[model samples]
Target chain A: MQIRKFHVYLTLVMFSTGFLMASSIELTQSTKKSRENENELQQEMSLNERIIAEREKNRSLEIQSLDRQRDISKIEEELAKHETDAAGLLANLEEARMLAGTVPAEGAGIVVTLRDNPSSNSQNVIQNIVHEQDIWRVVNELYAAGAEGVSVNDQRLVTSSSIRCVGPTVIVNGVKSAAPFVIKAVGDPDTLEAALHLPGGVVDVFDGFIKIESGKKENIQLPAFLGDAKVGKSVS
Target chain B: MGQNRKITFILTTISAIIGVMLAVQLQSNLHPLQSESRSITELRKVLLQEQEKSKVLLADISKQEQLLSQYQESLDSVDSIGVMKEELSRAQKQAGLASVSGKGIIIQIEQDPILNEQWDAENLPLPDPSNLVLDVDLRWLTNELLANGAQVLSINNNRLLSNSSIRNVGEKIQVDTKTIRMPYEIKALGNPDTLISSMKLEGLEEFFRSVNMKVTIEERENLVIPAFNGTKHIQHMKPIKAKGDS
Candidate 1:
């Protein structure tokens, strides 16, 4: 009976050890798959620290920018109050500011959003990606249809604005933005909407490659060109 | 007794492996993401936002500096009117209201000789014209020019303003509503050598040649980019006053 009891205990030990071995094997397999991710997580922590520091720097610079902007505008307002051509020039200057996209604006317009085909089964990936040409097409169409003001991802398209593609990101007004580009143009909402919807229009041409949808908004707010609109001397 | 001892040894080894696995699993749990569930994608999104904020704020600081210096110059001048007029003209030029003439480069893109030959030979059923002057190509070219410091740009006399757009509309290319045909002449006012070198460096001409388009780049001393005659009236966009007192 003692020998039998010893056998029972040995069997129990073997059975439990086998179970533990099976479960641990599965656990280690998953952990092996996640080891690369562990390294990434550590890198992500460092990235977090750097971003926090950058944001703090930006906050202070923003305050300094606001102060300088207030001072310049104050002088401009004072000068506009003076005699004759000054007021007219100020009015023209305001109009130019609108043209230069130096001031924020809001009006009835249409918002067109373009994004990558989420389920694109196309063999050519490059064709499906949103190229700068794709953006130029839509913006051109909007302007042709009489869009008074246009902004791509809220980066106002100034004379000097260059839209280029770098890797998977598109840079607008020198700011990097990923997909789901939002283009807002201040114009007759009906006209802009119809222009994009015309047969073989921008939406149709970009059918398989990009997914485009537009809506008319009563109050489409657009920010000013945050980038420098500082122009050098125009040689006569 | 020997058989029992060998079994016991095997069981101990197996348990030892299990212990190591358990310790490793515990270690992984202890070293989870800071938020416990944040994915790499979410972290990247936050990073991109922070980077954009920095870029915008940096540009803002520089622009404000330009404006402040202009204000000081206006205050220092004996003739504030002259200073305001100078500012107005500069704004006008940027708005494409004032005509600009200077040293720059002209890029012309048109149909290849083979394409016209094929069109004539193929008759009504043209073989899927591929290399015709595409608006996208023009946009790319003009963007390249602009990137190379081309201050003023125009397509076929249609001066590109701050809001100007070049687009392919119904088989024709339009520069802000002005339809331009084949032999697209793009005029850019800037440094001639810089523009020419950039065009060459981009291998735009070679790329166009391979794609069945004729490319001509010329450096001209007296290229005149006319003022934008198109009415860009500030109809919809109401300028938000910088100062509330105004």
Candidate 2:
């Protein structure tokens, strides 16, 4: 009985030790696996952070490139404007030079002065005065005679002006220019005179109502253009 | 007692084995779902990239369209200028003047007519203001002259063009926003004979006569019409060509 009891105690001790050894081996394996999982998680976290950073960098780069493109477009627009202005200026300069040489230094065509020829019986000639449209006709004829340029009283003609009757006075380029209207043109002396002498021409219509006179002069001087020409937008 | 203990031990062991099986099954099931989630995330990223690319392409297309419009406008302007230059050159040659550079004619129209001597003071007829000359008549004259080959027209030193307006407002006439009063001096650059003859045509001469206004036509060998007196607003139209497009 004593031997049996001792043997049982030895067997229990060996079994317990074996169990402890097996548990230790399992714990070590679990610890190693846990460590490996931790390493893998760290690597994944680092890669994710790098990807996020790269995306942000790319987004910023895109924004910067768009801004640069916009700036370039603005610069190009400004450059185009400058070029157009430069071209306009050059054209104007060339026109001025050409006009300087082409315009006759001296010679006068027919000068037609239109005014309200006072009625011999009426004291108030201003009351029954001339309207603006009649003046436009005479001016038109002078121009048709190849007049290079013209002015109403002191106001010179430009590229964008009109003559119309406002109340009793004739408005010229928005200014009130009164008569005796003196219209001056410079062209072929003989041809200009004949053009005005046409049977139904403006001069013929003047007849007895207004005084129309034509005479050749030794020299006629026309003023140079004083204002700028309006250049509109280019329409294709 | 021994049987009960053995049964309890067997039950505990069976529970442990079942828990291990459950854990393994749960892990396996979760793996595919996680992979699917990752795939969704990657798809979203790709979609975002594609959206950004499309936006850039749209901007490029807009830029190209603008450039094309601008180019077309420039070409049109050049063509118009060329035509004007050619007409001017031809007109100059016809005038027998040097390089077609010389003065034009000046026509003056008186808007008021003198009282008829045949009418007595007691029977004096009042004239209607509208019956007097108008700016339209001048415009007609200008058009006629241009049709007859006048290169340029100016009313009271204001150069008249195709786009010019001669409108009357509340007894006032505005030309390019400027109000002009008569008598108006119409200046034109062309062959004096042709222009005068064109103005003498039926509608024009009769129109003046019907109004009883006095028209004085005089041709000057040299006439200098003035430039327009107003501001020109800038306009930006479309381009005719795309950037870097052949």
Evaluated with DockQ, which candidate comes out highest?
A: 1
Query: Candidate 2 at residue A170, lDDT?
Result: 66
What would the TM-scores of all predictions be?
0.69, 0.32
Q: Report each candidate's C-alpha RMSD, comma-separated, in the order given.
A: 8.3, 29.9
TM-score of chain B of each: 0.61, 0.52
lDDT of 2 by residue, B1-246 (tens): 665555556556655665665566556545532222243355455456545544553554454455444533555545434433443343223222222234457778665445343333547675678776665665657655654556666677665532345656567665645677877777777678877887786356567766655677888776655444454321111111222211
Q: Tell me how candidate 2 scores on lDDT.
A: 0.52
On residues A1-236, what C-alpha lDDT tens digit does candidate 1 reach at each position? 54676677668767876876687678767765775766876777887787788878877775676566567657777777766567787778778877877667778999999888857777788787788888888988898788888889878888878888888889886677898899999999999999998998888898887889899999887777765554434557
Report lDDT per candidate: 0.77, 0.52
Q: Which ten contiguous residues of candidate 2 chain B have the minimum total lDDT?
A: B233-242
